[model samples]
Each structure stands twice: as C-alpha cells, then as structure tokens.
Target chain A: MATQDKSSIFADIDEGEVDQEDENVDRWRRNLRLWRETLAKQWRMLTDDLMVRLAMITIAFFMIVAVFAPFIAPRGPLTRQYEGDAGIIIADWVEPSFLSSESEYLLGTTAEGFDIFSQLVYGSRAALLVGLVAAVFTAGIGTLVGLTAGYYGGKIDDTLMRIVDFLYGMPLLPTVIILVALMGPSLWNILFAIIVLQWRSTARVIRSQALSLRERPFVKAAQVAGASDWHIISRHLAPNVLPLSFLYGAFAIAWAILAEAGVSFIGLGDPNTVSWGTMLQSSRAYSALDFGAWWWFIPPGICIGLVVISGFLIGRGYEEITNPELR
Target chain B: MSDTGAPDVSDENPLLRVEGLQKHFQINEGLISSLLRATMGKEADYVHAVDGVSFELERGETLGLAGESGCGKTTTGMSLVKLHEPTDGRIEFRGMDLTESDDEELDEFRQNAQMIFQDPFESLNPRMTVYDTLAEPLRIHDIENETARIRRALEFAELQPPDHYFDQYPHELSGGQRQRVAIARALVLDPDFIVADEPVSMLDVSLRAGVLSLMERMTEEFNLSVVYISHDLSLLRHMCDRLAIMYMGEIVEKGATEDIIENPQHPYTRSLINAVPVPDPDVGRERVELAGEVGDAIDVPSGCRFHGRCSEYIGDICETDSPSLEQKAEFDDDREVSCHLYDSCGKQS
Candidate 1:
C-alpha cells in the first residue's frame, strides 16, 4: 500500500510538470498573436484618417524646420551682415536698388537689413523648443501630482486640489508678468513661467480621472496583487490617463506658444532674441505702421498663426485616438 | 478539557486569527452645519462597518464567512487582508501579527495572502490583454521565468488549451472564462492563502457551481488555506470545512459546517438558514420572517446586538448585558453561540 501511494504521488507530480510545460508554450503563442492584433489596429487607424495624416505632416514640417534651421535660413539668424552696396540683408530684400538695380528679394526684408523669410524660418526653432519642452514639463508635473492625489485620495488629494484651485483662481496674466519681472525675460524663463501656470489644469483633469479610476476593480486587483502604490499608479492608473495627457499636452503647447508671443509683443521678451513677438515689438519700435514696411510684421504673424493651428489639429487627432467611445 | 487535545494551539498555532476588528466611517455633514454640530457636542457620527468581530482559521482549512448585506462580512474579509485599515483588531497570519507589521512586512505578507474579487467583469484591467494581467502578479512578486509560471497558473485554474486564452482580452471572453482568468491571476504567485470575496456569486447559477468546484479543487491541489466569503450559506456549507455566521459585525455562531447547519443555536443563524431557498418543491420549510431590518452597526443595540431583531429573546438580560460566545453545553466539542436564550435554556434544565 505504501509503495502504491508513493507511485501515485510521483505520477501526479509528473502529470503536473507535463501540464505546466504545455501551458507555457501556449501562453507565449497567445501573447504574440495579441500584440500583432493591437499593432494592426493602430496601423489601420493611422492610414484611415485624413485629418490625422494632415496633422502628422504639419508636425513633421515643424520638426524639420526646427532641426535644420541653419541650412534652410539664408543667413545666420543672429548675425548682422550686409551685401555689397546694400545697407543690410533687410535693405537688400526690400529696396530694389540696394542689392542691384534688377534684383528683388522674394519675401522682402526688415528695416534692419535682416531677411524676413530667414527670421521666420529660424524663429521656429526657438518657438518649437519652448512649446514642446514647456508643455512636456507641465504635463509631466501635472500627471504625477494628479495621479498621486487621485489614486490616494483623502488628505493628499484635498491638499493638492486646494493648491490647484488657488493657482487656477489667480490672475494668470499678472502672474506671468510678475514671473517675467522676477526671473528676467529669456526663452527658458518664459518656458518656466508657462509650465508653472499651465500644470494646474492638467493636474485637475488628471486628478478627476484618477478619482474615478482608483475605485476600479483593476486598481483593487493591483492592490491585492501586492503592488506598491507606485506600481499601481504607473502600471494601472497612468496608462488609462495617458490619452488625456496627450490631448492636454498638445493643447498646452499651443497655449504656451501663444502666451510666449503675447508676452514678447508686450515688450516682456528677451531683447537679444528674435521671436515672432519680438519681431512685432521691433516693428512697433521702428514705427513700421507709420513707415508702411509690411515686411517686418506680416511674415512673423503668419508663422505664429500657422504654428498655433497645427497644434490644435494635432490635439484634435489625439482626442480621436484616446476616446474610442467618441470615435 | 485538558490543554493537550490539539496541543493548545488556539493561543499559538492559528494560521490566521482576527480579534475585535472594527471599521467606522465618520459622517461629514455640510461644512457650516458640521461645525455648529461639533460645538454642540454631537460633533461626529460613524457607520460602524465592522464592529468587534473575531474568528480563527487553521492551516489548510477553508473557513466560510457568511452573512447578509451590511453585516460586515465583506468588511471582515477586507480587514483580514488589510484592504481597509481595521478600526481596532489584531490579525495574525502564520503567527505574525499583521496589525503591527510595517509597510515592508505588510508587502511581504500581501504576496503570500492574495484576494480574488467578486466582479469578474470589472476586476480585470480593460487595457491589458490576458497575458499582461496574468504576468503582473508574477512580476510584482519577483516570480522567476514569469512566462512559464503564468502558463502553469492558467492551467491550474483549468483554463485549458492555454494558448487560445493567452491572447484574448477580458471583453472577448465569456463570463466563465473571465472568472477563470481572475482565479489564475490570483494563483500565479503560488500563494499560501487566498481570500475569495464572493468569487462565484456574480456568475450564472450553472456557472457558479463550476467555479465553486474549481476553487475546491484548486484548494486541494495547491494545498492552500482560504477564507471563502459569501452570503450563500448552502454553497458555503458545501465548500467550507468550517463556517462562521456574522451578524452586524459579530459572529453569532460558528462551528464545523455540518454541526452549524444541522443544529444552529443562535436565532440569527437559524433565520439565515431558513431564508436559504429550499430547492425541493414538496418540502415546505417555514421561512422565519426576521423582525425589523438589520440594526445600525454604529449605534448597535444596548445589550445583545441581535436583541432588537431576535425572535427567541430571553427577557431584559438580552437587552442589558451582551452574551459572550461560549461552548454549548449539549455539544461538548465543536460549537459556540452568543445568545441569552441558550444560556437561559441551559439554566432552566
């Protein structure tokens, strides 16, 4: 009887091992197939939408312009130089006689002898950098705070939300003005200001999302699975809020760009840098309206408009991808 | 009895033991009103969710905890697993005091003690496919070669032909399939114990029996100790080795399943048993209609917690001094009751 019992136990153990091996092989195959399915779905979405394709092209153009500004611009953006017999590059482009009797700059030039086209192209680098970086900074901070506060409600949530409310209620324009005054006007400083002001709204949205998500059974499952607070926030909670983050990030970039331009137009921008807002400020300083030099302001204004429009399109595309119910 | 019967492990050898567990939620009235009420000395009111509950489970045994809604059955389960911080209690799992364990220790304890939630539909993450969901616990517990373990666990839960299910999302699967995935996820870590919180209650009646039988099989195959919580006493009796009946956050009666079902001493237990729908059409068992709704746990009755609703109340003593759970005189070995009627009945004899 003892020998038979031992033999049966060994047989059971052997059977379990066989079952386990078979299961492992099956699981690997299933994971591969699911991943392929998800990838296929995303690929279909990418190819199907015209608006999404347009937004992608515009983003690609902006990125290329930003990356290859030196090669694309006619002259160094910051250098003040003149062609022979021309007052400066700007005069050469705008005044027909400055470069040659028969020559005309296609896009004209500023009164300071700088090429308007070149400045418009090069200015994109700074605007794109500030917009992308500042939006990322704002979104990252907001997502973390929102995720933490939302996932772990009670005192932490109350305190963080109160801070968000206080910030949201503050006069945003005046706060930016004061921030510029304290930090001094520079690209990085302006970026900092935009992020500080912008993070609150994202935090509020994320917090509300987190509040709803924290009570979800998946979150409870994560908790029971011995997941740490950080693990639960990152693995289960963060992914759900990511689509919202992407949408908010794009919108925030557009807002930041507009705000930067507004501050520069109001004479709060760096005196050394040549941003679209600074171009407007310089044009205003030269009394371009009085002199009728349309070359100075129109190109920069158009660039700003185009960038903001592109940002909105990208944001809309992200909204479509994130919200399947809407789709 | 002498202290040598089971080596007196009641004080030392319990695998999981809970004592005097309570959870109270403070009601926050509107701001101005609450402030005024605070000054008037009626500052706060509480919902005594789990009020002074206690129970024990030995290693390798399934303890079925059953009670009606709002009776703190789920709360008791949650407290044992530390899902909610107990208002007051000592929970010992494998002789380690859970209440005093620090965060690191609690984390370690959690890896050993997992919970399977009720709702199969909502419990799993919608974003993750079956593979990632199963892989999550294994990754969290640092289980090695997770792919192999996940497959093994899935098979253990009887989700056979594991390849077909490996890629399927919860939405794609049927209700039974999703529950199997839930159980597989819980079992991935090779946990020593599990808290199944009404695991099969939400499934169809036909599907419920399958899930219940699967759990029993897993319990034996894995040699796992479990706390099977539910409102279905009949299912509990079928699946559990021991049974504890909770009423308003306290266990009114507890014993081996056979003993408790055959001869329930507490009025509350008898009522619950009567309420269990008789499956046979011909056997018309009299349904004991309980008096009043279940009492408020926050401000429970004066003496006995069940006195207000108990049908077999033994006079004013039932209203003034709460009866303590003691071994019944008739059953020398395995049964306990906390009711004045039992005590008075004994005295009369």
Candidate 2:
C-alpha cells in the first residue's frame, strides 16, 4: 500500500510538471493560441449574428477610409482645380458628371472648389475620434459614480443621484451648444461637452444594475470575510457591471457623434478641422438643391446615417450577449 | 446596564455568551404612512425577529438551534456573528463585549467568526473559480501560503485532487461540489467558530449525511465551535451536543440533546418533536398538531406566545403573563424549560 501511494504521488507530480510546461511553452505560440481561440469564439458568436456583422462591416469600412484618406480621395480637400468649360474657367460649385473626361471628380466639387469626396473621406476621422473618446470618458466617470453610489447607498447615494437628476433635467443640446460656443468650438472642448451631458444616463443605468447586485449573497459573504468596501466594489461588482457598460458605451458613441454633427450644423463646429458635419454645413452655403449639386450633400448624409445605424447594431449585439434572456 | 441579572461571568466563562439578545426590524413606512403617523403622533411598527434570546457555547461545542419556519432560529444564528446587529443585547466572545467593539476589533472578530449560508449556489460568487473562492478568506486575514491553505481546505471538504476543481466555476460544478466549495471557503480561514444556517437543507438527501459527517469531523479536528441552524429536529438530534428549541423569537426549551428528545418539557418543543416523521411503519407514534397560522411578528401575543396553540394550558395566567426559563425536575440531565406547566407561574399555584 505504501509503495502504491508513492507511485501514485510520483505520477501526480509528473502530471503537474507537464501542465507547467504546457503553460510556459514559447510565449509567442501561447499568444497565438490565445488569439486563435478568441477569434474562433468570436466567429462562432457572430454566426447568424446579423447586427454584429453589419456593425463590423460598417465600422471597418469607415476606419479603412479614414486611415487611407489621402490615397483614396481623388484630390485634396483644400486643393483648387480650374477647368474651363468653353473658356469660362468653371472652377467652383462643379456639378456631378460621371461621364466627363476632363477630371476624375466622381462626386463633384464644393462651393470653395474643394473636392467633396476628399472632405467626406477625411471627415470620418474627426467623427470617429469624438464619438469613441467621448463615450469612453463618459462610461469611465459614470461607472465610478454608479459603483460608489450603489455600493454605499445612503447619504452618498442620495447626493450623487440628485446630482445625476439635476444633470438629466438640463436641456442637453442647448447646454452643450452654449458650452461649446463659450469654449471656441475646439475638438477637445466639444468632446468635453458631450461627456458632461452624456454621463448622467450611463450613471443612472449602471446604478440600477449595481443596486440589484449589491444584495446578492456573494457580496454578503465578502462582507463577512472582512473584505474592505473598495475591494468588494472593484473586484466583484465591476466585472459584473462591465458587460452592460459596454452596451451603454456603444449607444453613447452614436449620440455623441450626432451631437457633434448638430453643433457643426449650427455653425459652432471647430473651424480648423474638417468633419462630415462641416461638409454638410458647407453644402448649405451653396444652395445645394438650387445649384443641382446633389453630390455635395448626399455623401456626408449617407455616411452619418450608416455610422449611426452601425452604432445601434453594435449596441444591440452586445446587449444580446450580456443579457441572454433578451436573446 | 452593567448587570441585568444575567448569568455570572467568570474566568471559566464559555467561549461565547449571549445575554438578552434582541433584534427588531422596523417595517419601512411609505411617504403617506409616515405623514399620517406624524399627524397621529404614533410610532412605527417593528418586527421582533429575535426577541430576548440567550445561550452560552463552550469551546469545541456544537449547539443546534431548531425551529419551524419563521421561528427566528436563523435570525439567532445570524445575530451571534453580528450579521444582523442586535437592537438590544450583549454578546461576549472570549470575555470581551463584542457589541461595544470598534471597527478594527470587529474586523478581527470577523476573522475569528465566520458564517455559512443556507443556499450553497447563492452563497458563492458564480463568476469566481473554486480556487479564488477558497483563497479569498485567507487573503482577507493575510494568512501566509495561500496555495497550501486552499489545497488543505479542498482536502478538508473532501474535494480530492484539489487541482481538478481549482479552476472550475460554480456553474460547472454539481450542486454537491458547489456546496463543498462553499464549506471549503469557510474552512480555509481556520476560523474559531462557524454559524452554518441550514447547510445541508439545500443538498440532496443522499449527500446530506456525508456533508454533515464531514462537518462533524472538521469540528472535532479544528476544535471549532459551531451553531447549526435548521428546522429539521432529526438532524439536530444526530449532530448537536445540546439543542435549543425556538418558538416565535424566544427559546422555549434547551438542554442536552438526548434529554430534550427523550423528555420534552415545553408544549412547543413537544409538538416539534412529534412533527418529525418516524421511519418505522409498524411503530405507533403520537402526532401533536397546533391550530392557527403563525401570528404576526409585529403584533406578538401579550402572554405566553405559544398559549394560543399550546396543548397544555393551565389557566388565565398563561394568557396574561409569559413564563421565564427555569430548571425542571423530571429529567436526570440538566434541562431548562419555559412553560407554565413546568413553572410555578400558573393559576393552580
């Protein structure tokens, strides 16, 4: 019996060593294996997942165009090209002529003689930047506030929730526009305005979720184990609330981008930067409909619509994963 | 407040001494109710979940708190560990007044005292792996060698080859395994005391005996004091050294488990013992069924709380005043009963 036990223990030790070796095998190969597994899981999840597929395709297209805008656009956004029709030098407000052999202006030209296609391509970078950055900051602040409020619910919760309610009651768009106007319409200033107005909704949603989770027995067990409040909130509460926050983040991005576009439409946009909103704003100056330059207005509008729709699709896709009951 | 005629405290004081423990929870009033109460100059209602319960536990003792649903047995167990702070009471652990301890002292107390919940599945964090759950208490107490502690705890819980279960999530393990993991988590800290609230009630019938025997072995091996709360008296008789029968929010009878079972004094305890089903078909047994639903905790009876459904009612005194716990002469072992039949408070006296 003693010999049998010794042999069994040796076998177990050997098995442990084999497992350790398996874990430490070439770092790059391990990373590659991890990446392969993650991709396979994502692929399986995306099978028949129309919303995720559509969102991925839309965002990927926008990202590619934004990254390689200079190569993709027929001409520079600020470049001037003078092509005379019957020696008249018709340079500005050029109409869409797909069959014209003079130049490759597939979409046309803006009122300032800038290629409209180039403006549309470059516009994606600003829109995506504001949307992604604002949403991330908003979600970060909101999650912190929500976790603190929900976990230590009493005077702290009441104070924080009242502040949230106050922010929620404010007329969001006008307040943001006023703030942006005062700040001189810089990109960072607009991003800050979006975050301030947007975080209340995220805080409210995450607080409700955290409130329900606070009473679970695991939390009570942690309390009994003498775990500090900070440990409980960060280690236990945050991970459970993160998936829902991702869903909230996706929606917040769409709203932020739209808010930026609205600000630009009202002529409060940053003058130095070119965005999809600015392109649309410049079209209004040319009396686009009367001038028959449909190309100038249509491309930016379609881009904004597709991007916002993709945001909703991504948000819903995450919602389905986080809340399986919804699926 | 220094002394309220409780049992004398001496150098030989038990590991835990609870005296006049009372926990009343106020029923939260809505806006309209509060306004009306303010206008009427009336106080809000309260549910006396644990009202004036007291007991003493020696080192390495296993005390079973047995009662039916809503009898406050669970509440008593919880109050002992300060899970539910007592509205009025004194809990002395190791001769120090736990009720007056500061935050740091209470944290130290939490390290010494731990609790196991009724539902194993709900007690564990579904997202945490078995190793993580077991390591948490050790981490909290700053115990060294966490890996060894976790492995030993897994072995104590009979989850052999701890590595097989180290990374398994709660959802992947069977109900019995999850419950074992919960047990291992409590055992990992090597606490001096544990309050297991219906630990085996949620498990399958086949798994219960194994878990209970494991708990029994652990208690002996670790010299751990334990309060086992359950509605099942048969289980108590099997495991407890002493048994306290709870009715409403008070202990009606308490004594050596065998003495209490062989000769029950209080009517409530008698009925509780009778309610336990007998396995033998040929053996005849008497059944005592009390009438009426459990009365509201907010409006407890003025006199003996059990008199409304008690089988042995002496007279008007049983309806006017309650009886205090006193020694009875019928049993050879020391047994205390709180019934007018066993006391001199009845009208016949």
Candidate 3:
C-alpha cells in the first residue's frame, strides 16, 4: 500500500505539471483568438462610418508628415539668406528685385529671409509631440488616481478629491505663467505644465464613472471569486474605465495642443525651435498683417488651424466609438 | 424530534455551524458635524445589522433563511461566504473555524464555499462570453484539463448543445439562460457549500420554479449543503428542509420546515407565515397586519428586537428584559422561540 501511495503521488505531480503546461497553452490560444476577434470588430467599426475613416486617415497623414518633415522639406528651417540683390538693397530691407524676383522660395521668404515652408513642416513635429505626450502623461496619472479614489472610497477618496478641488480653483493662465517661470520655457517643460494643470478634469470625470462602476454587481462577484484587490482593479474595473479614459484622452490631447499654442504664441515657448506658435509670434511681432506678408504668416496660421481641427475631429471619432449611445 | 439531535434525515453531521453572528455598521453622527466630530473624541454610533443570529446546516440539506428586506438575511448569507466579515462570533465549516483561518486558508475556504448573486442580469459580466464566465472559476481554482472541465460543467448545468452557447455573449442570452450560466460558474469548482442569495427572486414567477428545481437537483446531485436566502416564505417552505426566520437582524424562530410552517411559535414567525399568499381562491386567511414600520435596526428596541410590532407583548417585562431563544415545550427538541411570553409561561399548558 505504501509503494502504491508513493506511485500515485508521483503520478499526481506529473499530472499537475502537465496540467500547468496545458493551461498556459490554452491561455495563449484563447488570447490569440480574442485578439483576432477584436481586430475583426474594430475593422467593422472602421468600415461602417465614413467620418471615422476620414478622421483616421487625416491623423495618419499628419503623423507621417510630422515624422518625415526633415526629409521632405527642401531648405534647412533656421538658415537665413538675403534674397534678390544685396548690393541693390536699401536700409537692409529687400532690393529692387525682391518684388519681382522669379527665383523665390517654395513658401516665399520670412522677414529674415528664412524659408516659411520649412518652418511650418518642422514645427509640426514639436506640436504633435507635445500634444500626444502631454495627453498620455496626464491621462495615465488621472486614471490611476481616479481608479484608486473611486474603487476604495474612504479617506483616500476624500483627500484626493479635495486636492482636485484645490487645483481646480487655480486660475489657468496665471498658473501656466507661474509654472513656466519656475520651470523655464522648453517643449518638455510646456508639456509638463499642461499635464499638471489638465489632469484634474480627467481625474474628476474618471472618478465619477468609476464611482458608478464600482457598485456594479460584477465587481462584488469578482471580490467573492477570491480575486485580490489588484486583480479586481485590473481585470474587472480597468476594462470598463478604459473607454471613458480614451474619450477624455482625445479631448485632453486637443486641449493640450491648444494650451501649448497659447503659451508659445505669447513668447513662452523655446525661441530657437520654430514651432507653429513661435512662427505666429514672429509674424505678429514683425506686423506681417500691416506689411501684407501673407506667405510669412498665413501658412503657419493655417497649419495651426488644421492641427487643432484634426485633433477635434479625432476626439469626436473616439467619442462615437466609446459611447455608442452618442452615435 | 430525533435522538441524534439532527434536524434532517439525510445526515447527522453538520457542515456549517454559525453561532451568535453580528454585523454592526457605525453610522457617522451627521453630515454637518461629522467633519467636526472626526477631530473630537466623540465616537459614531452603529447600525446593528446582523445581531445575534445563529443556525446550523447538516450536510446535503437545504436551509432556507427567510426575512424581509433590511432584516440582515442577505447580510447573514454574505457573512457565511466571508464577503462581509462578521463583526463577532464563530462560523465553523467542516469543523474548521472560518474566523480563525489565515488568508491562504480563507482563500481555500472561499473555493469550497461559493455564492450565487440575486440579479442574473447584472451579476454576469456583460463583456465576457458564457464560456469564459463559466470557465473562470475552474481557471482560478487551477482545475486540470480545461476542455473536459468546461464541457462537463456546461453539460451538468444542462446548457444543451454547448457549442451553440459557448461563444455567445451574455447580452444575447435570456434571463433564465444567463442564470443557468451563473449556476454553472458556481458549480464548476465542485464546491461543498453554496450560498444562494435570492437566486430565483429576480426571475419571472413562471421561471422561478424551474430555477429552484434546478438548484434542488444540483444540491442532491453534488451532495452540497446550501443556505438558500429569500424573502418569499412559501417558496422557502417548499424548497428547504429546515427554515430559519430572521427579524431585524435576529433569528426569531427556527425549526424543521413542517414545524415552522404548520406550527409557528413566535408571533413574528406567525406573521411571516400568515403573510405567505395562499394559492386557493376560496381559502380566506386573516393577514396579520404588522403595525408601524420596521423600527430602525441602528437603534434596535430596548428589549426584544421585534417588540415594537409583536402582537403578544406582555407589558413591562417584554420591554425591560431581552428574550433569548428557548425550546418550545410542545415541539421541545425541534423548535426554538425567542419571546417573553414563553420565558414566564414556561410551557403552553
């Protein structure tokens, strides 16, 4: 009997190991199938609406442009030169040939004879980076804090909400000024300022949504299933909260972009890097409106308008996907 | 009454023994001054949610715990599964003290004791397909050979043609089908005990009996000891082998089903039994209209919890000393009643 028991124990151990291997395989297979199904569903979503497809394509086009601007633009963005004949020029302004110069740049010349097209192309990179990165940082922090506050509603919730309220009361423009002054003006610093101020709204929205989701019976069922607190948050709570987060994140991206433009248009952004906002700043400083230099200012202004509009359209597309009720 | 002191004929061994269970929620003073009182030494009072409730369930027996809303019936059921930790007392399952178990042991105990929630519509994960929902417990408990286990569970729950339903999302299924899937999920782990918390209450009246029968069949087939909780007393009388009646967080009466229904001793029990709607059109029974609303469970009555609504209150004695459960002389061994009338009168002559 003792020998038989030992043999059975060994057999059980072997079976346990086999079972573990089988489960791993099964989980991988299941996850693969689930991914395929999700892809199929998203494909259906993409094909169903013209607006969503258009929005996606437009965003994609801008991203490609932003990535390959260095290769695409003809002249170096910062290099300046005196156009027409320098010898014939008076008071260091343009020469007689400037008005009728057939050998002009693609987007014409700026006040300093820099290529406007090159500046616009290169500025897209900074604007897009700051907007996307800032939105991601703010959304990630907001989601974590909101999920914690909403899932475990006690002193933690109260303290976090109080902090949100306190932050909400601060004047936006003045706060940005203070932050920029303290941290010094750079692309990364501007992104940081926008995220620090903007995360409160996302946190508030996420907390409200989470407050409703936490009371859901599935959450309690997950608790009774012997799931730990972390498992409950990640598995049960996070999936439901993600759609809302994505919706808010799209809007946050647009907001961050606008805020970055506002700061840089007022001369707080990096003076060296020619962002669209900085281009606008230089155009306004030189009074391109009074001088009628459409090539210098109009193109950069149009670029800013197109970027913000694309961000808004993308936000609307995401809103429709996350909330079918809205559709 | 049997000589072995076992209420049910199936087995003499008790699978679960709950003694003096209590759950009190401390209600903060008020909205305005609670913030101020937090800093001061003043303490918040409590709502006595599940005060001094006790019962025992033998192996393979269905014990129905019936009471109105806010009477702590659900709280009692949750306490057994350790969903809400009991404030005081002991719950012994399979001779192991549940309150004393560590986190690991408690987890093992949770695997042994499962729960079926009330709302079939909201209880399930709308995002998950029926297969994943059913397979979740098996995965969590580390059951071997997933395909076979899932097939067997689906078959056991009578989800016929498993292939047709396995890939279907929860929203596509009917309420009854969703509930069947929920039951399949609960049973997949092969648990020894299950807490059915108003499992059939949310279903249509026509569908209620079918769900109840399925539960009954599963209880016998799996040899599971169940604590079936509901507010419907007639259903309890039909489904359970033993019955425990709770009033304002206290079990006022408990006995075999026949004894509690046919010969209820406590006034609260009598009121509950009388409230059960009779099916026969000609049989006109006097509905015992309970006076006033149920008193605050937070501030329970001074003496007996049910004294505010009890019809047979015996003056100051009923108001002064709280009554403890005593065995009725007529059905001495089987039935217990908590009333001052029984305390002084000793036995009904």
Best by TM-score: 3
Residue A246 displacement in candidate 1 (angstroms): 1.4
DockQ score for model 1 = 0.33
In the order shown, the chain A TM-scores of the predictions are 0.82, 0.83, 0.86
Give stretches of model 3 more than 4 Å off.
A1-25, A39-43, A46-49, A83-103, B1-13, B28-32, B38-42, B343-349
lDDT of 3 by residue, B117-216 (tens): 9998888887677777766766666656655556666766778877678778778998888888888878776677899999988888888777888888
Per residue, candidate 3 scores C-alpha lDDT tens digits across A1-327 of 011212221233335555445443366677678768966885677447776677667667778988999898887788775644554321222222345576456667677667777888898888889878877877888888898898888889899999999989997667876798789988888888888888898899888878888777777776667777777777677777776777677777677777777888888988778788888887787777787776677787787777777777767776777778878
lDDT of each: 0.79, 0.81, 0.77
Q: Which candidate number maximizes DockQ?
A: 1
Q: What is the TM-score of chain A in candidate 3?
A: 0.86
Candidate 1 per-residue lDDT, tens place, A1-327, comes to: 011212221233434544444434455576577668876886577546787677667777978988898888877655654564644424322643344455355455666766666777778877888789977988899999999899888889889988998899876667887899799999888888888889999999999999999888788888887888999998899978987887789888788888888888888988777788888887787778787777678878988888888788777776777776767
Interface RMSD computed for candidate 2 is what? Answer: 12.7
Candidate maximizing lDDT: 2
Candidate 2 residue lDDT tens string, B151-227: 76798789999878876778888878888888888877767688999999999999998988988987887778899
